[model samples]
Target: MPPAKLKVGLVQQAVSDNDKATNWNKSAEQVAKLAAEGCECILLQELHSTLYFCQQEDTDAFDLAEPIPGPATEFFGELAEKHNIVLVTSLFEKRGSGLYHNTAVVFDRSREIAGKYRKMHIPDDPGFYEKFYFTPGDTGFTPIQTSIGKLGVLVCWDQWYPEAARLMAMAGADLLFYPTAIGWDVNDTDEERARQHGAWETIQRAHAVANSLPVIVANRTGFEPSPNPADPGIQFWGQSFITGAQGEILAKADADGETTLSVELDMSRTENVKRIWPYFRDRRIDAYDDLTKRWRD
Candidate 1:
C-alpha cells in the first residue's frame, strides 16, 4: 500500500515583547488561514505566546508559564476543533509551583491534547539562558499520536542531539517536528554568525537524511531586545524550513518576515529511502554503551 500524504503548514512569524494575548491571537489567525487553505496539520514556533524572553533571568517571566490545560492549550484546543485540523504548539508549561518546562503539545483534530514532549537539552549559553527558567523534560523520547499521524516533536535545543532524534525515530515516529526559537547574537562577527547559522541548519538537515523521515522546523523572526540593557539582544534569523526524507529543502522563509509555508509529504518515501540507505539497519546499537554516559572520559 502507498504511504499516506498530508499537507502541513508551518507558521514562521516574529513575536512581540511579553504580550501573550496578541501572540496567541496572531497564531490563531494563521492557523485559521492555513486550515482554510486545506492543510491537515499546522506547526507553530517555540514559545509562540511570548517573546524569546529567556535572554535574561527574571522572576517575573515565570508568571507567563501556565498549566497544560490552562488558557493557552484551551485556546489551541478550540481552534483545532473549529478548524478540524491537528495542531502542534510549543508553550512554557507550569508543571507546578516554581517548576516549569519548555513543552510541545500535540492536539488531535478532536481538540484534545493527545501528548506532549518537554525539552530535554536546556541550554545555558550566554544569551540563551534557558536553564535558569525551564526544568529539563522528564517525558522520554516518544512520538505523539494524532489524527494526521504520529508526530516526533522536539523543542529547540533538543534538535541538536542525535540521541533525541534517533530515539524518536526508533519509537516509530512518522515525521519529526521541531518548534524552534533560535537567533543570531549581534555581538558576534559576520563570519561567526554565518558559521553558527550554517551549523544549525546542517545538523537538523542531517537528522532528516539519517532517519529517512521528513522534518519540519518552524522558527520565529525579527529582532528582540535584551530585557537587560547591558547585553545586546539576539536577532532571530527566521528562515523557517521543511525538509524531505532525503534532506532536500522543500520550502524556506527569509531572515525577517512572517511566512506560512505549506508543504506536502509523501509519507511512503521514508521506507523507500531507508531501504536504500539502511542507516538504521546497519546501526552499531550493541557497541554504543558510552552514549548513555555524560562524557567519554
Candidate 2:
C-alpha cells in the first residue's frame, strides 16, 4: 500500500533586524496554529531568525549563524515533538570562524535531527549579497528521509537549478521543499517587481511538473533595509505556497502577510505520475556530460 497523505504547513512572515527572540516566538506561534489545523510538516523561510540581513556585508551578521544542534534547533526540536510533526527550517550555520553556510535542517516527527542540506548555489545579486557571508555548501544533492517519505530540500538559489531537483528525484525523494528568501529591490518599478515574483514562482512550479513531486516554499515578507548605505533596501515578497505533483498551486499566501497555510499532499501521486509520464525511464544521462562543466566551451 502507498504511504498515507500528509498535510503540509508553510509559514510566511516578516522579520526585523537581528531579532532572534522575536522571530522564534512568531514562528512558534505559527507552528502551533498550523498543527491545530492538522499540518503534519512545517517549513519556515530562509535565515528566518533575522531579517534578510545579507543585503550588506556586515561583520555583525556573523553573530546570527549557529551550530546545527544549537539553540534554535533545540527549541524547534521540542516544538516538533509537541506537535508530532516534521519541521523544516532554514538557518545560518556557523561551520568555523569566518566560515558559514546557508542550510536547511529537518526535524523528524520524532523530533530528532533527521537530515540537512547545505545550499549549493549562493546568489550575488544587487541588494542580495549572499556570497559575502555564506561559504558555498559542501553537502551535495540529497533528500532528508522522514517517517512520511524522503524530502528533497534545497535553499533559495538552489531552487533555480533543475539539475539539483533531478538529482533529488533520482535519489528517490517523495517531495521537494525549497526554504526561500527572495524579493524585490525597492527601487524596481511595480511591473518589474511583479515580473520577478512571477518568474520565481513559475520556475519552482516547473520543477514540480518535471520531477512529479510536491513542492513547498516558505518565504519571509516585509521590508528590510540595506545594511549598506550605498545599496537600496529590499522588500521580501512573501507569497509562500505549496504545489502538488502536477505543479498545480495547492495553497498560496498573501505577498505581504503573516499566514500559516496547510495543504494535503498525496504521497502516492509521485509514482502514479512517473509511471504515466515516464520521464525517468528515458534517461539521457550518457549524453549529459556538458552539464558538469562551467559552461559550453
Candidate 3:
C-alpha cells in the first residue's frame, strides 16, 4: 500500500502567449519550488503549454497540437524523474492528422509517461468553443497509479459532472485532480463572477465529500484578450485549491494571483471516512440505468 501521508502541490499561473518553451519553463520553476519544499506530487493547470486557444475556433489553432511522445511529455517527464515526484500535466494532444484531444499526462517519478487521461467532456459555449478543437476522450474514468497513490486526473469541463468523479472513485482512485482552465466572462457583474467561482469550488469540494477522497485543482490566472478585437476577454480565475476527504480546504491560492498550493494529504482518511460514510456500500446500482440516456424526458 502507498504511504498514509503524502505531500501534494499545485501551480496556478497566467499564460501570456502560445510560446510552449516559455510556458513550460515558467511551470518548471514552480515545480522545482514545490519539489524543493518536499512535495512528492505536483499538478500544473490545464493546457499550461499555451494560451487558451479554445476561446475561438480557427484552423490555425490546430497547429498548436503535438504528438504524445513529442516535446511536452519529454520535458515534464525529466522534471518528474529529477525531483522524484509524481507530476500531472495537461496539454493539447495531436493524436494523428486532424485528430486532437485535451489530455492530461501523468509521470510517476520517472522520465517516462505513466498514464494519460483525455478530457471526456467537451464544452461548446461562446468564448469557449472546445468541441471544434477536441475529440471526446475514449479513455474511461481510470486512475493513474504512481509512487504516492492513485490519481484520478480529469480536465477542465469534466469538473462539473458528478458522474465523472463517482466513476473514478469507483475505480479506486485515492486522489481526484482537476487540471482546469475555467474562468468568468469579465463582462459579468461582480456578483455573477462571485457566484460562478463559488459554484466551481463548491462542486469539486462536494465531490471530495461524497467520495471520501482528496481533491486538488489548478487553474490559470490573468486576463487573456480575445483574438477577435470586438470581444471582452476571459478572466481566468486562479483560485487553485487542495481539499481533504471531508471537503475541508487545506490550501488555496486567491483569485487573480499566480501562486502554488501545497499540503500533505492523509491517505488513511479515505479508508476511515468511507468506512463511516459507506456511500458505495449502500448504493442501488440497479435503479439508475437511465443515467446514460440524454435525459429522462
Candidate 4:
C-alpha cells in the first residue's frame, strides 16, 4: 500500500528569459530546499525551463522542443535521485520532425525516467495558442506509480476537464497534480480577471470533490511580454495550491510571487471520504455513452 501520509512540495516561479539553464537552476535550488525539509514528492510549474512562448504562434518556436530523456529529464532526474524524492516536471517535447507535444515527465528517486504524460487538451485561444504547437497526447490518462503514491499528472489545460480527472481517479490514481501555466489577459477588466481566476480555481476544486482525491496545482508568476508589439503579454498568476479530499484548500502561494509551497497530505482521509460519498459506486456508466460525442445536438 502507498504510505498513509505523504509530504508534497510545489515550486512556482517567474520566467524572465529564454535561458533553460538559468530557469532550471533556479528550480533546482527550490527542489533541494524542499527535499531538505523532508518533502517526499515535488512538482514544478508547467514548462518551467523556459518562458511561455505560445502567446503567438511562430514556426521558429519549434526550435524550443527537444526529445524526451533529453536535457530536461537528465537534469531533473539527477535532482530526484540526489534528493531521493519523486519529482514531476513539464517540458516541450520534440517527438520527430514537425511533431511536438506538451509533456510532463516523472522521476522517482532515481536518475531515470519513471513515466511521462502528454497534455491531452490543447487550447487555442488568443494568448494560449497551443493547438498550433502540441499534438494531443497519445499517452492516455494513466497514473504514474511512485514511491509516495499513484500520481495522476496533468498539464495546464488538462486541469479544466472533469473527464480527464475522473478517468485518472477511476484508474486508481491516489493523487491528482496539475503543473499549470495560466494567467489573465492584462487588458481584461478587473471583473473579468476575477471571474477567470475564480473559475480556474473552482473547477479544479470540484475535481477533488467529485473524485475524492487531493489536487496539487502549480502556476507560474510574473509577466512575459509578447513578441507581437501590440499585444499585452501574459501575467502568469502564481497562486500555486493544494487541496484535501473534501476540496478544502490546504496551502496556497501568493498570486504574483515566486514561492516554494509544501503540505502534508493524509491518504487515509481520501479513503474515509470515499466511503461516505460513494460517488463512483453509483455512477451511471452504462447510460453515459453519449458523453463520448462532441455535442449532444
lDDT (10s digit) by residue, model 3, range 1-297: 558888999999999999999999999999999999999999999999999998888999999999998899999999999999999999899999989999999999998999999999999998999999999999999998887778899998999999999999999899999999988887899999889999999999999999999999999999998898787889999999999999999998988878998998888999999999999999999999999999998
**What's the distance in Å from true for residue 193, model 2?**
1.4
Per-residue lDDT of model 2, residues 33-81, tens digit only: 9999998889988888887878877898888899978988888888899
Candidate 3 — which pairs collide?
none
Local accuracy of candidate 1 as per-residue lDDT tens digits, 1-297? 223888889999898667888888889998999899888899999999988889999999898899988999998989888999889998999999999999999888866788999999999988899999999999999999876778899999999998899899999898999999999888889999899889989999989998988999999899999989998998998989999999899999888888899988888889889999999889998999998899997
What candidate 3 gets wrong by more than 4 Å, as runs, is none
Model 4 Cα displacement at 247 (Å)? Answer: 0.7
What C-alpha lDDT does candidate 4 achieve relative to the native structure? 0.94
Write down the worst ten-residue block by lDDT for model 2.
1-10
| Candidate 1: residue 5 lDDT (0-100) | 87
- The number of residue pairs in model 3 that clash at the backbone is 0
Order of quality (lDDT):
4, 3, 1, 2
> Estimated TM-score per prediction?
0.97, 0.97, 0.99, 0.99
> How close is each model in CA RMSD to the real structure?
1.3, 1.3, 0.8, 0.7
Candidate 2: where is the Cα deviation over 4 Å? none
Better of 1 and 2 by lDDT: 1
lDDT of 3 at 274: 95
**Which of candidates 2 and 3 reaches a greater TM-score?**
3
